[model samples]
Target: MKKLLIALLTAASLSACTTTESFVKGADVGWLPQMEASGYQFRNRDGKRQDALRILKDYGINTIRLRTWVNPSQDKGSGHNSRDETVAMAVRAQRMGMRIMIDFHYSDSWADPEKQVKPAAWRGHDFAQLQKDVYDYTYDVMRALQSAGVAPEWVQVGNETRTGMIYPEGHTDNWPQLAKLINQGYAAVKAVSPSSKVVLHLDRGNDNQWFRTWFDNAKANGAKWDVIGMSYYPYWLPGRPDYTASIDDLGRNLNDMAARYGSEVMVVEVGGEDDRPQNTYDMLVAVQAKVRAVPGGKGLGVIYWEPQGARSWSHYALSAWGADGRPTKAMDAFLRQP
Candidate 1:
């Protein structure tokens, strides 16, 4: 009877773990505060005025992703993801019962596959100082968030670092150096908030070879990360392949990543052309299913990039909000049941 009771208790504990690790339905709203400051108003499907974050919550978004830039500009569309702003936003989202994922761009502007320009202040620093800069900056941000009563569930060391981050010094070609820099960020994150998972992000989620090569190099160089974050934007691919053509590849890659590294995987960024709400909705649904299907539940979640940044406001074509101030039908994809 004691053994039976122990087994039952173990099962209940497993069930509780599963409940706590629910699939994340999230949005990267780094541009939200700027948009709201510029006088943009968000409305629900019924066209009633509403707080933008609340509107997102009602659309089934339970997680919020915000980017942080090192010395950002104040330009309307090109700036304002400073540390203070990020902490404030995280607090607001947390108050609304949303989980937070913090993306570190490590640049004054955007940081991605094509451009990872070093921040102006860090440009002149030698390799050793650069590593120190990465660690100090990451530590400062994490500490600030902690002091604000917000603990990020995931913290990206760098954004879309397909080639590597912090430019020539930290580029993938110099994997050894890049690994050191990455480790600095990872160490800093753990120092401030040990439970927050550190993510090593890359673009092209469907390309398994690319991911394998990059991660293999990272592993050999002793870089550390808890999650493999991917950006899967079919519309942004060179030929603009349809999501249907590559989604299966995404699924296979997600499973392979989980099995290969024994780490959680997440479609940290995804989007579709704003004009085709139906198509975008379908793609989002499929993407979530693929993530959910990862064996042992290693798949963490999907987060649409700046979904509330309407085309009219940001001149971006992938947002899920309409020019009419209402969320596009694509936002409803998150509302669908797994």
Candidate 2:
């Protein structure tokens, strides 16, 4: 009887683990609230007006990614991802039964490989104070979400920090400082929401060597994170190579990052040109396939960056929405079986 009970318990443990792992189909809709506020209506393929989030959910997006900026400008084209806005959006998405991923840009505006400008409030702070700022800001945001009954499942410490964040202060040239800043954000996230997985993101998902070099340095400098987040944008890649030319590399990189670091990996951002819906659809399908193929279920998800930010309003070409306020065929890629 004891032996049989032990076997059953072991099986239950394995089953629980399996059940906890889910392949995330997510979209970064940081611009959504602004879009809606600007009277941008979203419609399904059938042309009936609908809530943007509902349209996304109907297309199989189970998760919503929101980016929060520090003291963001109130500009029409480039604002409105503030803490209050993020919390409200998360609450709305949570109420809709969608998971949330909070991306901390740690800047007043966009933070990416090309730029990681520090918020104006943190401008003159020395390294030590900057670290404290990162922690306090992260903790405050997490606490706000918690107070609003929204707990993000994944919290990105920084967005696309290939050269590092916070400009000259946290640049890759000072890995030690950057690592400390990352740890501060990670610690704050865990302090407020213990179950939230911290993500460290970088651009160039298909470049295995770049990932290796960046992560190796991060590891050496004691940067802690739960997931390796990557941005894969073939549309922006130099010479604009087709997805076929580099998808295998992305797959290999995903597998390698997982095996090498014992951490889950996610394509946190990916998008193709909006004008080429079929090509974008095929690219998204292939990207999801690559992520799902990662060994040991280490590929957590793929997120479309600002998919609903229609080209008409945002002038960005990578969105999956058409000028007519309907999702293009590219959005259907999420419905494809893995």
Off by over 4 Å in 2: 1-21
Expressed as tens digits, the lDDT of each residue in 132-223 for candidate 1 is 99999999999999999998999999999999999999899899999999999999999999999999999999999999999999999999
lDDT of 2 by residue, 1-338 (tens): 99999999999999885552378999999998888888988899899999999999889898999999999988867777999999999999999989999999999988998889999999999888999999999999999999999889999999999999998889999999999999999999999999999999999899999999999999999999999999999978899999889999999999999999999999999999999999999999999999999888889999999999999999999999998889999999998876
Candidate 1 weakest lDDT stretch, 10 residues: 14-23
How well does candidate 1 score on lDDT at residue 93?
Answer: 99
The per-residue C-alpha lDDT of model 2 at residue 107 equals 95
